[model samples]
Target chain A: MQGYIVKRILIAAFTVFTVLTVVFFVFRLGPADPVMVMLPPNATPQDAENLTKKFGLDKPLMVQYGNYLKNAFRGDFGSSFRFDEPALRVLLMRFPATLKLGLVTFILSVTVGLSIGLISAVKPDSIIDRIGRLFALAGMSLPSFWVGIMLILFFGVTLRWLPIAGRGTPLHYIMPAFCMSLYPIALITRLSRSSMLDALKSDYVVMARIKGVPEFYVILVHAFKNASIPVITVIFGIFGALMVGSAVVVEYIFSWPGIGRLVMESFFARDYPVVQVFVIVVTCMVVTLNLIVDIIYAYIDPRIRYQ
Target chain B: MHSNQDNLLELQDVTTTFFTKQGEVRAVDGVSFSVGKGEVVGLVGESGCGKSVTSLSIMRLVPQPAGKIVSGRILFKNEDLMEKTAEEMRQLRGDRISMILQDPMVAMNQLLTVGKQLGEPYKFHDKVRGSLREMCIRLLEKVKVPAPESRVDDYPFQFSGGMSQRALIAMGIANNPDLLIADEPTTALDVTIAAQVLKLMKEIQRETDASIILITHDLATVAQICTRVIVMYAGRIVETAPIKIFYKNPAHPYSVGLIRSVPVLGQPVDRLFSISGQPPSLFAMPKGCRFAPRCNKAEKKCFKHYPPETWLDENHSVACWLYPGD
Candidate 1:
């Protein structure tokens, strides 16, 4: 088990390396130049050269890449041309907000989704099942931006009960977080419901019932444990995806100060360093989350625990 | 056959059906039988003969909405099971009655440890002052599971199919249940493992005096362990007889065909004897006798009308026109 975990961590590091290399080259190959975005439109050729030299743009792509890779290892992401501060520092500042939002949404979606699924599975043709099915249908198909817009319209413009944008107060997170969580909630509900339905039909579940286990214990303890295996996989995958960043559209609509919005702003300003740094941080989050997910998988399935 | 004697369990016209999208299927149609105290009665039949469904109905573990015990009187210890509320049935099960399922692999929750699963019913039904850890280890030892102390913490996957079945047997006999139902317990195992499981079940029966309903399709197995046998064909009980009479002088044609199919040590044969034709479908049953289409001895009258169970003697009975009088 220790060997497997070490192997997984190695693979995760290699994945981040590949991603970082690809993103760096992609940024270099893009049409806009960071130096041009940094300097004024009427700046002289000498001014452009000085700025280029200052940012190491005059160096060969290989040299700059080597420097970038070396500095990335040391947590020294170069200054953000947009923020005029170190890219790593800027990201670290914004990360806590994104982490908080992500964790809250993750907890809510999983709790609510599994409950709906469990109830739906137990009484398949009941009203609860019907309503859950509809929620799942809308949750998966509808776009987050559209959902965010609708939430804003209903809760923001119509009722004026909550703030539309910014991230200081607790209420500020409601609209965007709800919008961002919609797809995962729906997917988890549908996955849990189907898997739970299948688990409930299994012989072990029937055996539990025959053992005279209470209905509540039968459904939750016996049936739900088996049902939640598949649900756990999908859920942790979603959490890992969201851990890196929230939906850009939702963050933008709510003016949420998260890494998603940060990445978008850097892309707009043609700030390659900040964009690269943002990608590295987010990808690292994803890789780490996946490692945690794999460990959790091993914990739940004994077949993997030995491996 | 034991109509006047005291019995541990009695099922009279216990009919169960499943409602599928296609139509309603009479899975267990008017099935009737009885298991006396300390009796090991074999409920033997071909697959889809409603053996498993019959066991499930008795446990009240039949899937709801789709599957229902439409009509039945399952009398256990002088109590009508059908009249009992769900709560009452819950208390009766795992306490007075328990069941072990067919597939050992899927018969247990993969996530739970064997000890936890074993202790579940014991915890609910038995009120011991301390832990059931000692009981679980002893039960495991009784079933001859190796390394009971350590293996109890292991999950179902850690145990082999045969060993898992042993744990299941331990679980079935845990609460000292009056009646234990084993549904195809050895069907998923190898022949050697199957014999061992049957032997363990016999041992458990001896130890607990728990009357067992051993559900299986293996007739030879029934003869080896069960004292009395109830033969079902296409969801109906075609014959019920003492195991010796069932083997020496089989009454029903199906029973004769079944025993004939078993390979004897020195008997030279062209091919194994087989009762040809499939069991009738649930949706479109035969006009009269359910097994008429497959019975070589079936007469014109057999296809024209149904035959009631007729007693050849006090100990043997057959549901065929050949034996019309009780």
Candidate 2:
């Protein structure tokens, strides 16, 4: 098991390195110069030259790449032109907010999704089951940004139960988190519902019921564990997706000051270092998520012991 | 309730049906039998002949939204089980009755350790807490599982086919129920393992003196373990007799053909005996006797109306038009 984990970490490290290299090349490919983007409009060519030399932009591409890789390993992602601070430090500060949002959304989605899935599987075709289906449909159909706006309009503007935007108090997180969680929740609900339906029909469940296990234990303990195996895979996928995409729209709309919003601000300001660090963080997050998923799979399913 | 108060289980005109897009399928139709305390009763049938459904009905676990026990009663010790509330049934199950289904590979929850899985019956029905670990180990050890102390902590995947089936048997008898229904307990296993499982079952039965409902398609398995046997075809019981009598003199043509089909050692014939034609589908059952389409001795009247069950002797009965019906 330790060997399996070490192997996964090695692969993840390689993937992070590849992502960094790609981001480096892609950002440099753009016509914007880091020095000019940072300098005032009236600054002279001499000022540009000095700034370029200062930041080592005049150095050969290979040398610069090596330095960037070395500095990235040491937790130095250069300084953000806009923030006038180390890009890694800025993102590290904002990291907790994004992590909090992702964590909240993930927990909320899993609990609600699995519950509805189980209920639907138990007495399927009931009124509540139909409502759950429609709920899933609505969740899948609406975009997160549109959903976020609608939530702001209803819960934030009309009812005033929650603040319109921003992240601080517990209330501030609800609308954006709900908006962010919508699609994945829908996916989880649909996937787990079907998975649970199949599990309820499996022989073990029948045996459990035959053993005179109470209905709750049969459904929750026996059926739910089998059903959640596939659902967990989908959950990790959703978490990875939320970390990258939905958070951007949600953070932007809510002005939550998370990595997504930071990414947008840095891109607009052509803060290359900040953007590079952001992309690299996202790449590493996904790699780490995949590794966690593998470990969890082994734990949930006994058949998956790593040699 | 009958004068034979020793009967542990009695099914009276139990008819379980399934509603589908096609039509209503009578999976178990008018099936009635009685199992005396400590008697091993074998329910023998072909595939899709409602043997499994009969076991499920006895357990009150017919799948919902499609299958339903449309009529009749299940009497355990002269008390009608059909009248019990769901909660009461829950209490009765695992306490007075437990079932081990076929296919040990899928019969156990994969994620649970053998200890927790086998410990469930005692927890739920017996409420025997605090010594669950020891209880599970004892049950496993009783079933002759090797290294019971550590094997109890292992998951289903860690056990082999034979070992898993033994674990299932242990789980089924954990509460020491009066009746244990084993549905084809050894069907999923190969010959050697199957024999071992069967032996374990008989030994357990002898030790506990619990009544058993052995549902299987294998006549040889019946001959080995059952004291009484019921032969069914297409969801209806065709014959019921003591094992020796049933094997020696099967009145129902279907029963005769089934026995003839089994190959005996050192006996060679130009061809093995077989009942011709497929078993009738539940959805499209014949108006007359269900076995008439395949029975070589089927008469003209057999095609017009269903045969009423009749007792030919003091202890043996057959469901065929040839037998005189009162």
lDDT per residue for candidate 1 within A1-307, as digits (tens), equals 8877888899999999999899889888888777777889899999999989987889999999999889878988888877789988988888787778887788889988988988999999899999999999998899887778888888899999989888888888788778878888898899999999998998898888877788899988988877877787778765777544445667777888887788788778777777788878778877887788788877777778886
- The candidate 2 chain A region of ten consecutive residues with least summed lDDT is A298-307
Best by lDDT: 2
RMSD of 1: 2.2
Summarize candidate 2's per-residue lDDT along B1-326 as a digit string, tens digits: 23378899999999999999899999999999999999999999999999999988988889888999999889898899889989888888878888988899899999888899998888888667668898899889999999999999999988999999999988889888899999999899999999999998999899899999999999999999999999888999999989999989998988888898999999888898888899987778999988888878889999989888898776788989888776
Task: List model 1 lDDT by residue over B229-306, tens digit each.
Answer: 999988899999999999999999989989988999898998987889888988999988988899888899999898
Minimum summed lDDT over a 10-residue window in model 2 chain B is located at: B1-10
Worst 10 residues of 1 chain B by lDDT: B122-131
All candidates' lDDT scores? Answer: 0.86, 0.88
Clashing residue pairs in candidate 1, if any? none
lDDT, candidate 1, equals 0.86
